[model samples]
Target: MTAASPRIPSPLLLGVGLMLVAFNLRPALTTVGPLLAAIRMGTGLGTTGAAVLTMLPVLFLGIASVLGPRVSRWIGPDRGILLASAVVAAGLSLRALGGLVPLFAGACVAALGIGLAGVLIPGLVKREFPGQAGLMTGLYTMTLCLGAAAGAGLTVPLQDLFGGSWALALAAWALPAVLGTLAWAPFARPSRAPVAARSEVTRPVVWRSPLAWQVTGFMGLQSSLAYIMFGWVPLILHDRGLSAVDAGFVAALMSVGQAPAALLVPTFAARLRDQRGAALAIIGLTLATYLLVVFGPLWLVVPATLGHGFGLGGCFGLGLTIIVLRVRDAAGAAALSAMAQGVGYTIASLGPLGFGLAHEIGGGWVLPSTLFCALSLGAAAFSLGAGRNRQV
Candidate 1:
């Protein structure tokens, strides 16, 4: 008798697993912003140290992403993701123990998990939902924004409920990580196909492609802006005289605003002949709205924050969509995804660091605002090339 074929997960199971995993990607990063003041007060972390604390996770995200392809090859994508989720749970749980060392260490570990999932998920989307890549990516991105909003919006309340313990509030995110890991567990069984058969016949060298570089540039620059929102925006608002609760509320609102755009932009972009126009429009919107939030009348900050969120969300959704659109096969998508996020996020980590340093040195938001503008313009320049209807 012939040997039995390995069982594959149903589409429903796969879809649920994918979204749950996506939902775990942003919480660890987002929770920090709302609690930064409390964390600093408790740990004596200065502004620069706070920046480093924020920047550390992103830096490690980039470093870990570069290893994604290799890990997938060795363990399979399903197993890799399972491992990633488990690591994230452990990291978040570690954060609950308190102290500077635990906080930073936990962030690094959780970020490594997030980075691994980030690189692999796109390729999985390409492989499993080839016809619906855009929609699926939109859903994935939307889920990420929702997770971010939850973390931003709920941390303070959780802290208050837990007798003012920021660490406990931060640790609460681990529950989602655990759920994601459990959801993905059924799919992590060993495959009947040989490992070699799962890989590309001829792997594309993504690092050498000019178009790939443009995509990476766009991803990096936009991600810098996104991380800035996660790491410093609330603090910036607080500095501008908003109460902590109000500042966190605005940050949460920004993240909530991202969800609709995140779900819509990639779907719309995919139907177009090219995404160039969409890219330009969103980048302009992001830059304009961000400036308004930083400098416009306080009465208008809420609306500006929402607009900024929509712009950033659309930019991020398009960035992921471009990666899928630029590749014709799953292997190519995996390679491109690795390049875009690996080098891209390394470039991204500098944004928070730059903002913090600029604030410290210039002693005001002017210098940080200048840096934001420069980064936004650079992203626009690269998006022009990345948005082309061409395969890498």
Candidate 2:
């Protein structure tokens, strides 16, 4: 008789757990931008220092992508995810425990936590919800968008609630971290015997295909643009005469805008012959956002931000779907994911750097918006090439 397949967690429980995990993903990166004034004032950090805090979590995320598979080898995937969640709890808690130096340390730990878990979740959807990859991917992504929105919107008010201490607001996220870890305890246990290798696992030979780099390049470029929005968009808006709260609202609105497209984009992308059309639609929307940011009427802010939210949100799921769809199987996909995330995140880290330098030189948001428009167009062009049926 055939051995029974291991029963995955219940669909509802799995979905809830996924949402909690997803919620943890954005707080480390997005929270600071919303509370930049508080953080800068409280910590006495200059713009460069604040930017490092913003960029390092993402940079470490890329680093964790390269490290995740080895981690998976040590612990079974489920147990590995549990371990990563524990890291999240530990990492976020680090910020609560100390001063400025510890804050950056916590960000790095949190980035590593977010990065490793970020890489694994797609694989989990493939392994546990194989028949429903499309649905699960969309759901997880939407929850991620929601979590990002929560962190973006809540950071300021939370600071106010706790007598204007940013650290307390930052620490408050630990509650979710603990809850998610507890809810995920069952799958946290390792299940399989380790595969013994007679020798060290060699680096798998890579197929140096243009398509591979193109796929990775798409991720890198899109993420570069996304991080600029995350890191500085609110501040830029505030400079243009919006109040700090209004700017935060706009930034939060941009993230919330993505929820609809994030949920719906993957379904269509999964059904498509390739991801080109969906990617083009999203980038095209980004171009529109640039137009509004640069020269549209004042009333256009809402629509432009909404388009940005939807496009960027949809792009996240579509990008992940492309990685899965383009690869032949799980191992190849994992390897490609590692490459894409590592390279992509490294490239993306340039965004905030570029924005700051550009603003310093040009003295306003105008030039930066133009530069991003060009990047958006470039993203559209590359997405067309990456979204092919051939293996990347």
Best candidate (score: lDDT): 1
Each candidate structure's count of clashing pairs: 0, 0
lDDT of 1 at 291: 94
Q: Give all candidates' CA lDDT scores.
A: 0.91, 0.76
Poorly placed runs, candidate 1 (over 4 Å): 191-204
TM-score of each: 0.97, 0.91
Cα distance off (Å), candidate 2, residue 170: 1.7
* Alpha carbon deviation, residue 21, candidate 1 (Å): 1.2
**RMSD from true fold, candidate 1:** 1.5
Error of 1 at 250 (Å): 1.0
Candidate 1, residues 152-256: lDDT per residue as tens digits?
988988999899999999999999899999989988876445433554422456777899999999999999999998999889899889988889899999999
Residue lDDT tens for model 2, 1-392: 98775665677887787777787787777777877766777778877776676677778888988787788777766776787888887888887765788788988898888778877777667666676777778888888888778877788788889887788788788778878888787666554433223212122533376777787789878877778788887787677677767777888888898788878998788888888988998888877885685467768887788788888888888888877777655555666677777777887777776776676668777777777877777777779878888674
